[model samples]
Target: MNQNQEIRNQLIKLLEGGIAYQPIEELLKDITADEAGKSISHLPYTIWQLLEHMRITLYDILEFCQNPDYQYLKWPDDYWPKEVAPADQETLDKCIAEIKTGIQTMIKLVQDPANDLFKTFSHGEGQTLMREALLVAEHTAYHTGEVIVLRRLLGTWE
Candidate 1:
C-alpha cells in the first residue's frame, strides 16, 4: 500500500479499536441499563453519562471535520447526558449503537482517499481529518477504559 493508504489503514484500525486499547464496541456490549446507570462512589458520572459524552463528542468532532457550517456545542451541557441511567433498555441500546455508528462514520472518512487527511479544516484552527480521527479514537479509548473499570466495580464484567 502507498503512504496514504497505509495511514488510512492504521487509522481505521485505531478507530475500530483493540490495538493498544480495548474496543468500545465490545466493551459496551452486554451492559444492562442498571449497570449503565450505577455510579461508583468516587466517579462523578455514571456509565450512561460517559457513553453519552462519547457519542456527543464524536458527533461534534465528526461535524467539525465535515461541516463548514459546524456549530459548537456548549461545554459539559451539550456533551453530557442529564440522566444517570437510560430510561429503559431501548435507550441504552440506542446509545451503544450511536457510539458504534459514529466510529463507523469516522472509519469511512479515513478510508476515503478524496478526503486529504493532512489538509487542515477551513472552519477550525489547524485541525485536520487525521487529527480528528485520532482525537475520536483517543477520547473513546479513554472512556471505554473507564467503562471497564466501572463494570468491574459493579461486578458486571465477566
Candidate 2:
C-alpha cells in the first residue's frame, strides 16, 4: 500500500477503536435516552449533549473538507445542542446514525486516490485534506471518551 492508503487505514483504525481504551460501540451500546440525559453536579453537559456536539462538529468538519462553499457554525453556540437529552428515542438513534455516516464518509474521502491528501484547499487558508480528516478523528475520539466517562459517572454504563 502507498503512504496515503496507509494513513487512511490508520485513521479508520482510530475511528474504530475506543479513544485509547474501550470501543465506541461498547460505550454507546444499551444507553437509553434517559441515561444519556443524566447529568453530574458540576459537569456542564450530558452524554446526549456531548454526542450531539460531536456529531455537529464532525459534520461541519466533513463539510469543510468536501465543500468549498460551506459556512461554519457560530462559535461555541451552534456547536452545542439546545437540549440536554434527545426529545425521543428516534432522535437519539438518528444522531448516532449521522455520526456513523460522517465517519464512513470521512474514511471514503481519505481512501480515495483522487484527492491529494496534502494539498491545501484553494479557497481557504492553509488547510489540507489530511489536516481536516485528522482533526475530525481526534475531536471525535476526545468526545467519545467524554461520553463514556459521563456514562460511568451517571452509573449508566454496564
Candidate 3:
C-alpha cells in the first residue's frame, strides 16, 4: 500500500486497540458505572472521568482539524468530566459512540488522498492533519493504558 494507506491503517489500529496495548473495546467492555466511578488510593480521576476526557479531547482535535472556525474548550476545565461518576448507562453508551464516531472520522480523513496530511491548518495554531491524527492516537493510547491500570487497581481487569 501507499504512504497514506499505511498511515490510515496505523491510525485505525490505534483506535481498534490492537497494537501497543489493550483494545479500548476490551478495556471498556462489561464495566459498570459503579466500577468506572471507583478510584484507587491517590488516583485523582475515575474511569468515567477518563472516558469523558478522552471523548472531549478527541472531538476538540477532530473539530480543529475539520473546521477552520473551530473554538476550543478551556483547557483542563472543559477537557475533563465535572463529576467523577457516570450519570447512567445511557451516558456511557453515548460517550462511547461519540468516541468511536470521532475515530472513524479521523480515519476517513487520513485515508482521503485529496486531503494533504502535511498541510498545516491556517488557524490560531499551525497544526497539520498528520500531526493531529498522531496526537489523538498517542493521547488515546496514554489514557487507555491508564484505564487498564486503574482497572487492575479496582480489581476489575480480566
Q: Which candidate is the best by lDDT?
A: 1
Model 2, global lDDT: 0.83
- The lDDT values for all models are 0.90, 0.83, 0.83
Model 1 C-alpha lDDT per residue in residues 16-81, reported as the tens digit of each score: 888886677678889889889998998899989898899889999989988999998889788888
Per-residue C-alpha lDDT of model 3 across residues 1-158, encoded as one tens digit per residue: 88777876776676567776666676667778888888778988999999899999998998898888988789889899889988888888788778778878888888788888888898847789888988988888888778888998888886
Q: For all the candidates, what are their Cα RMSDs to the real structure?
A: 1.0, 1.6, 1.5
Which stretches of model 1 miss by more than 4 angstroms?
A: none
lDDT of 2 by residue, 1-158 (tens): 87778887787787666547676666667778888888788999998999999899999888888898988789999999889989978888888878888888888888788988899987678999888888887887888878878887877765
